[model samples]
Target: MDHRPPTIKEIARQLNVSVSTVSRALSDHPRIGLQTRLRVQQLARELNYEPNTQAIFFKQKKTYVIGVVLPFIREEFFSQAISGMETAAMAHEYTILFGQSYDDTERERKVVAAMKKQRVDGLIISLAKETRRFDHLQALESTGTPVVYFDRVPPFAEAHKVYCNMYQGTAELVGWLYGRGYKRVALINGPEKMPASRERLNGYIEGVSRKKHKVDMQLVETTDFSRDSTYRAMEKLLSLKHPPVAIISFNDYVHMDAVQYAHRQGVAVNKDIVFVSYANLPITSYTAFPPIASIEQYPYGQGEKAMDLLIQVLNEKGLPDAGTRYYCEELAPTLVMH
Candidate 1:
């Protein structure tokens, strides 16, 4: 009735009914008999009365786009996961936007807010290393945006995900190291705030501290995922009064960092240090000297699975609010020693 681009008023005049009745019937108010509501709806449809999306927002606002928030996609592992999401999105004909939180809590919050303002219908997220709280993630889900977490999700946070069976890889890697006669092994760990860090550390501890060959707790050095941090941590460990003859690094990325650190310290990688990196990315093989071995967790495959899971979630009318949906794969590892 505001004389804008035609609305219910014109429809009501054509149907010979009060504007209030048209509005109520259009809304399918239960108090108004079903037959009356049906007739009004039928007429509205016939007239092609396009309900103003703004009006709908005024009532129940929703946007159909999706946002994918990642800590950093610089790693090939993340690249694969993103591919999976893109493949699934293409199939569904849905558009996706990306946000890199860069491990800063404030930056992460800003990205989340931006996605909320854009009214994304869903989210696919991998928390930053610094994220210790799930309140922001939970709030978005509460608003009806389906969120599927992947990779480095919080330990206590319940959500859907696709990840690697780190324990399996660790057991295999550590068992091999012990077999190679590297008993006094050391672990250069990643940032404690990261899920992968804890998972990897747990696997290392459980694997080495078994029926045989127990690792020394003092040999473990905590560091960030960056090459510089890894190098620094490795330096501290190597400077130990009795340095470990073998080092099991966090991942291939960190493995490269550790390798470089050893090189700088006038030590040969395989010959002197006997290094092994978790998550054997192709980049690892191309290192100046390939690590003793690396667990080949196919990020490309993981990414594909992530997309598949997201599609399933989007297909479902309503996903369960409680419980978690997780898929973890333990793929074969390749030990390519130089």
Candidate 2:
């Protein structure tokens, strides 16, 4: 028994009409008579006819699908962003395929290659921490497939990028700490290679200068944004000859690790040492002793805007104007003081 799904040809043969007529009728072509269209539709329902989407997409020269690449999806921040993207894609009658790289550059490269091979119309990416080279991304662009980068984007790429203004946010937080009479301020930043880390470091320097405070090289420590790294950084900072009265961590997760270390060392958080960091997740508020402040990057809003821009670029014919060849959207982050 060679059982298969019913096709348009079978419907046409049964109705004694041409295959072209059946297709036009099913598509509701204006040239097709209403009587014939209704009859074809009725017969299609009776036969449980299903159109071949692949064939349709091939003829239209569009997949109507987008690929998304992220460092990891387990984080609440990334999950919220994915929700925003899915909402937008649903409204546009499109589907998405996701790939996670787990913060590995080699894995990210391979995932991107797979998406390209799948012939996705466009790509959205939040670069992995280990990603330093842009050759793989550049290769995708050469194929005329548009890519929109969100948080943790490559600094040198000329593609459409959307990210939070971490520099300004960090500067404001630092100044706020100074205003509260915290003289000795310490910073625990992420990898120096990351744009976010570099920007935040510059912001810290600017804030110190703006407050007319002396810059203390001993107070600043760079980490890999890991729990162990942040804990060690916190330990080192507390052991300094003149420990800082306030600390700014890389993000909420890293800040939590530092707080735990402070608790173990008998240092009262938000009392002995004022703490601040980026990523104002809901968990921050539920903590027994939360940080003094945090920066809300609005990950969902970033994702929505990034996806909209990508869709806009996909619809545009030919190359964009010279002045608008590359687009960058920077979303403002709010300083949420607890």
Candidate 3:
């Protein structure tokens, strides 16, 4: 009449063997004979016995869980990154706990605090657009919990990071535009507070300077990476005394706003505007008015590499030596032209 799951002790009693023998057999310990281990495993399977993860975690002082914090998962890049993380975590018998901040700094703080409360072994994070401070992340690291930041990483140098080379990507895109005879290029950038945004802006400036083109401050527009903000920015850019012959968007999602506005205004994209941006989703290729080209950031690869580095950090015992250099892996972005 009992509905409780069978325990190792019950399995031992049923097999008429010592508890240690049953435990060793279940674990496939080399000390246990093959025949006996097989018998114990078969019987354990028959009983639908599941190992107690809580007990195992307690014994080893490990949760075997990694927490992932992101701005949001609706974006294709973050979702693909999570897929990569899941693959790597599964291979090592670890699980992932996910949290989305929705680009809200307060919400991000709460999500990170909750993850800490859960006693996660490690953390992978992409900072929120509004997160200007690193106190929350620094507090976690001070507790000896390893953190790996990707995509929208902070200015912190001590923590591990995995990110795309946005500076190079932006520079190459701008140079290509100029080479194609597009002289006046406008940049619809994300918030200036973000390091990636600053890198892209710097690249834009450098590219223009390299081409001996005049840098027009009016051509640069900053936004919060919102649909409404991007649409408004595009409107302002087009209404300029001399609008740009080409435009570089902050990212593909923000570009969608510009595309929609262009459609409503009967403006022919790629031909009329010559848009370019960073995109990893397949949909970017199929869009009726796709950008002239996109920079492939390889979100999945970033996630995989981040997880690998985090696991390695977790395995190393003892505190890191003071002023020790940590790991930073920067992946190159490839240009995919339509």
Candidate 4:
């Protein structure tokens, strides 16, 4: 009547052999005789004896599990990235432990702590919007846990990171706008503290200079990537003495918010004021007014590369000078026209 699963000790009892012998035979250890191994295998199949994977993983000091943390999975960009990471992890006989920080720094720390408690082999994360201190992340790395940052990475370069180069794409976006006769372009950028925001700002300047147009700080606005914040930014831009002919948002989500605000103000989306953004998310295509062009950051590729880099780091953990090495990969983004 007992429903307990058969164990190696039980098998050893039935075969009148030592537990070690049963374990060795079950594993087909080279030291075990073929006849004994065959007997153990046959009994295991008949008795439905299953190896304890947790015990084996504990003894080997590897869970074969990777932790992934992102700001928001609801955003298609992060969803795509996680899909790529899952694909890469599966190829290596590993699984992913996923968490979302929800753009809160405190929540990010808690999620990281939970992952650490789970004893993950490695971690891939996109920094939260409010994350400023790297103490928690540094603590993880210091404890010999491999950590890889992707997309919204930290400001430092000493750590492993995989990200898209938005600066060049944003610059290209500006040039594209200029070519289409939208000379006076404005940028609705994210918080200035973000590296992504800085890249877009620099790109906007470079693109303006390339077109021989003077940089206009007045035309640029910063937002917290909120609906109300974007609406306020749109108000400020539209109130300018000389409003921009085109507007570039931090990303597709921001682009949608800006476009919606413009529409409410009786402004033609693609006519009176054009919009462009980054991420090139699929949802934008179905929107009533999508960006004329978008920066394709390839979130999925970044996620795959981040996971691959983490696996490499995990593989080289014990090698000489491996601790001192850091891997950084930057992918150049492309401009996709809607």
* Candidate that scores best on TM-score: 4
Writing each residue's lDDT as its tens digit, candidate 2 over 145-166 gives: 8889998887874778999988
- Choose the strongest candidate by lDDT: 4
Off by over 4 Å in 4: none
- Mind giving the per-residue lDDT tens digits that candidate 3 earns over 1-338? 99998999999998899999998999889999999999999999999999998998998989999999998899898999999999999989899999999999999999999999999999999999989988898899888788899888887778799999899888898899988899999999999889999999998999899998888989999888878898888889988989877888898887777888877877778777788889656777677777878999998999999998899888874756622658899999998887
User: Candidate 4 lDDT, tens digit per residue, 52-111?
Assistant: 999999999999999999999999999999999999999999999999999999999999
The TM-scores, one per candidate, come to: 0.76, 0.95, 0.93, 0.97
RMSD of 3: 2.0
Candidate 2, residue 166: Cα displacement in angstroms equals 0.8
- Decide which is better by TM-score, 1 or 4: 4
lDDT of 1 by residue, 1-338 (tens): 56456588887887788888888898878777888788889877876778776666557544445698887778787777788778777777666788999877779889998998888777878888888888888898777676777766667635776677676677667778888788778888878778888877888888787737656788889877877788789888888898988888887777877888888889977887788876667776566877767777766666566666766676663558433454343344455444
| Weakest 10 consecutive residues of candidate 4 by summed lDDT | 164-173
In candidate 3, which residue ranges exceed 4 Å CA deviation?
A: 15-17, 33-39, 319-325
- Give all candidate RMSDs, comma-separated: 6.7, 1.8, 2.0, 1.2
Q: How close to the true structure is residue 77 of candidate 2, measured as C-alpha lDDT?
A: 82
Locate the minimum summed-lDDT window of 10 residues in model 1.
Answer: 321-330
Ranking by TM-score: 4, 2, 3, 1
